[model samples]
Structures are given as C-alpha cells and as structure tokens.
Target: MTEIYYVEDDGDIGEAVKEYFESRTFKVTLYRTAEAAKESLRKQLPDLVLLDWNLPDEEGSLLCQWIRSRWKELPLMFLTVRNDTKDIVKGFQNGADDYVEKPFELEVLYSRICALLRRAGNPSGQKVISCGTLTINKEKMMVFCDGQEVSVSRLEYQLLLILMEHKGITVTRQSLLELIWDQNGNFVNDNTLTVAMRRLRQKLNQPSCIKTIRSFGYRMEDEI
Candidate 1:
C-alpha cells in the first residue's frame, strides 16, 4: 500500500483530507503538529509526505529541506492554504516535488498525488530503492558501490541489499530472515546477522549509514 504522512495543524481540515485519501484506498496518517510528525519519523519513512507551509511546532519548508537533504529519493508535496507565488517558489526551493494551493478540489489533490507517484516510478507497484553508493539490481544479483564493482558473499549481499532497500525504516530480525532465507521460523540468532552486517560494512566501507536502533532492529540512515 502507498503510505503517506499528512502534517498539518488544522485538525478539521487534516481529518477531512485524511478521510478523502483513505476513501481512495491510500494509507494516510495525519498529525496535528510537526512534533507529532517528527516522532512518527523515528519509526518509519512514508512513501510520500503532505506538508503544510505553516506548521505549529516547525515550518513545513524547514521539514521539507531536512527530508530532502537526508532522503534524496522520497517525494515531498506542499499542501497549504498559502497560494502566493513566493510561497510556492519557497516550497519548491525547499525540495518539494509538487505544490497545491489550499481551497483545492479533492479531485485535483488526488490527481496531484497520482502524478507524484508516477513521476517517482512507483505507480507500477515497483519499489523505489537506492542503496549505498550503488543501486541494487533486484532482478540480477549484482553489487556496485561508488560506480565500482564490489564483490560480496551471497548472504552478505542479500542482507545489505535488503537493509539498503528499506533505508530510513527499521526492519525486524524476523522480517530479515524471511527476506533473506525465505523461512518463517528459524533458529538464527543475532550473532549470525551481526557477522553478515560486519562483512557487508567492510565491503562497502560505509558503517555510519547502517545504524542500530537500540533494542530494536537495524535502520539505514536517510543520509545514505
């Protein structure tokens, strides 16, 4: 499902837009404040973001810039009542892919969402994955870091590739097993995964990108 985060201070308007998008079969999460939205970001990165120009806790343009710098591939759209050309330009300059002025028809908003998804190459149910210095060829088991060939073991490549594809989001150990081993329940322990991760990091030589989230699973930083 296409997951989207709607960050707006207006409760009523946010709720209404959330309902409208949910009715159209899109997974939408609404936040009343920038603080709340920022908290949600610690858990997972959504496919798209609907940002208001004026947020209570923080300006939407600031948040958009942060997302843009960290997650270079995620799509951000400004949906606000601010309709001035300056505001629109500011939003785009902050790295918004699309902008919609407020008092907009629901149809127009939906059309804009579709267009962003299409432009992101996600309309065909394909994942938009950028990993490490290299983009993983999911169809072909290949690895290219910094535009150079990097040889890795099969297990190491699979584990690193999965983490890279799900960068900015945490992946549980169970999920990792299913993705790499295609098994539901296994006797694998953290040590095994740690070995694989260490080897993968050694091959890539970028350890800061792969982060350990305390007691939780692993998450690749957005800056990567």
Candidate 2:
C-alpha cells in the first residue's frame, strides 16, 4: 500500500482527504501541523506528502525545503487554497511535485496523485538504501557491509533500515521504539535498543557508523 502524509490545519478538509485516500486503499496519516508531519517524516519516509500552504504552526514552503534537504526524491504536492501564480511558482521552487488548488474535485485530485507517484517511481523502502560500504536491500531484508552479507535479526534489520533512511540525523530512542517495536506489539525496553545497537554495530564491524548521542539517541553517520 502506498503511504501518504497529509498535512492540513482544516479539520474538515483533512478528514475528507484522509477518508478519500483511505477508501482507495492508500494508507493515509493526517497531521494538523508541519511540526508533527516533520517528526513523522524523520522516522519514516512516506511515498508522498500532501501538504497545505498555510499550516497552523509553519509555512508549508519551509517544510518543503526541510524535506527536500533530507529526502530529495520523495514526492510532495501542495493542496492549498493559494492559487495565485506566484504561489504556484513558489511551490515548485520549494520542491513541490504538483499543486492543487482548494475546492478541487476528488477525482481530479486522485488523478494528480497517481501521476505524481508515477513520476516519483517506487517508494524508497522498495529500493536499496546504502551509505558508504553499508547497503540494505529491503526487498530481501538483508544487509551487506564491506561487500559481505551480514546476518541480522528482524529487529536489527528494522533498526538499521530506519537509521539508514534518516542518515546524518539523530533518531530519538522514543521514535525508534515507536517505529520498530510498538507497531509489532513487541514490548521492548530501553536496554533492548542498546543491545540491538551493540549487536548491529558488532555484526557490521563498523562501530563508528552508529554514534551514541549521549542522552538524546543515535545517529548513523554518512561516512563509515
């Protein structure tokens, strides 16, 4: 299923869009603010984002810039009431794949979304994620380090994938738990994360790649 992150402050519009997408079998997560949406994006990259120009907390253009800096190829579309020519140009300038004005037909919006997804190709997780000598193949759920395949448990692979997906960014412990454990109904303690990190690093034989952020969490450095 294609995952979509929709950010819109208007409750009615957000709900309508969410329902419409969900009805079509697309997994949709709706956020009312750019901050919440950004937090989610940090943990996992959705297939596409349907952003609003006027978010409650920050301008959608700012969010666009932030997302482009981190996930350059992730598709983004502005679903807003701002239909001015400058606004449309600004949306593209900030890395938007498409722009749809408010009061749009659901059918038209769906078509645009399909076109954007087609242009963006497949979701990131379906492709190999690599940094330096480490490579992760999500299709086969395998990791290779320094040209040798490394054995990793399911949880370890999940942890590594998340870190690699958000390389160079500090991934908080809370976010890691929520993304890797809570979803699977696994009751993992903080120590489990530590253990997993230790084992993953040892297996990969690159201890310096994953750095402990003291009280914060962990960050996967781009260069190992």
Candidate 3:
C-alpha cells in the first residue's frame, strides 16, 4: 500500500482528509503537530508527506527542512491555506515537491498525489527490482545478493534502487544528493555519499557493482 504521512492541526480537516484517503486505499497516518510527524518519519519513511503550512508547534517549513535533511527522496507536498505566491515559492525552497491551496478538490489532490508518486518511480505497491546479482523487493523492503538474503539500511536500499533504475549511467553527485538525500550537493559533504556507497557495496558483496566515475558521480554496472 502507498503510505502517506499527513500533518494537519485542524481536527476536522485532518479527519476528513484521512478518511477520504483511506477510502481510496491509501495508508494514511495523520499528525496534529510537527513534532509528532517528525517522530513518525524517523521510525519509517513514508512514500509521501502531505504537510500543512501551520502546525500547532512548529512551521511546516521547518519540518520540511528536517525531513529533507534525512530522507531526501521522500516526496513532500504542501496542502494549506497559504496561497500567496511568496508562500508557494518558499514552500518549494524549503523542500516541497508540490503545493496546493486550501479548500482543494479531493479529486485534484488525489491526482497530484498520484502524479508525484509516479514521478518518484513508486507508482504502485509491491515492486521487484533487479540489477546484476542484486534484487530488491519493495513490498518486503528486502534485498538479495545472488540467492542470499542481505540486510541493508533504508537509505542504502533507496540509494541502490536509484542506481539500479538508471543502471550504466553516471549519476552525478549533485543529482544523487538531490534525488537520494534531498539536499543540495554543495551543502552536504561528499564523505556522506562515500560512506553510504561503501556500506552498500559491502552488503551486496560486490564492490565492482558500483563504479566511481572519478570527479563526477557513481554508476551501477549492468553486471557485477
């Protein structure tokens, strides 16, 4: 199932959106405060996050920044009353993938959500991805090297999936940070990528599976 973490302070609005999304077969977890939402994010990364501009404890923008710093690939959208052009721009700057004005049509919201998921390459549930000797089962969130099951962190799995999706192409460091880390490459230290790559390679037991394109980025070979 597609999981959504929705943060809204208003009880009526939160309940209504949660109920509607649940009806559409989405697993919705609603939070009335930014702190609670942040806590949930740390436990498990959701497919998408629907955030309100104003939370009872903190501004949604702050929460967005925190999330981006951690789960960079997670899709986030703003569903709030802040329709001002400045506010929209700020939302995007803060890390929102989409912004919707208040009193939105449920159909429109659903469409936007689907579009975002599609763009993120998670259009549906239970996807199996394979590259070289590695296989990833999305629903199970598990990885296998050859026929042996391998344990990997959530970030490692996300990084591997991105590389596998674009196998053979040198994914630039900046691109990796934007797509995998949700941070500007300039702001994040390159060592972060290095450590993650090292761990992933070790877990897969195939160091040659991922190649560093010296001064550029990394590439996943078609065969290990």
In model 1, which range of ten residues has the least summed lDDT?
A: 123-132
lDDT of 3: 0.79
* Candidate 2, run of 10 with poorest lDDT: 123-132
List, residue by residue over 79-182, the lDDT tens digit for candidate 2. Answer: 99999999899999999989999989988999999998988775454575666556676766778765468899988999999988898999999899889876
Error of 3 at 207 (Å): 24
Q: What ranking emerges by lDDT with the best candidate at the front?
A: 2, 3, 1
User: Model 3, range 1-224, lDDT digits (tens) per residue?
Assistant: 89898999998988888888899999988899998886655434567899999998999988888877654556899999999999999999999999999998888999999999999787223465556556666766777665457888767887888887787799998788778656223344578877888898887786466788999998887541
Of 1 and 3, the candidate ranking higher by lDDT: 3
In Å, residue 189's CA in model 2 sits off its true spot by: 28
Evaluated against the true structure, the overall lDDT of model 2 is 0.83
Model 1 vs. true fold: TM: 0.66
Error of 3 at 208 (Å): 31
True-structure RMSD, every candidate: 7.0, 10.2, 14.6
- Please identify model 1 stretches exceeding 4 Å from their true place: 123-155, 161-195, 201-224
| Deviating ranges (above 4 Å) for candidate 3 | 123-224
In candidate 3, the residue pairs with backbone N, CA or C atoms under 3 Å apart (3 or more residues apart, or in different chains) clash, namely: 72-181, 72-182
lDDT of 1 at 124: 18
Measured on C-alpha atoms, candidate 1 has an lDDT of 0.75
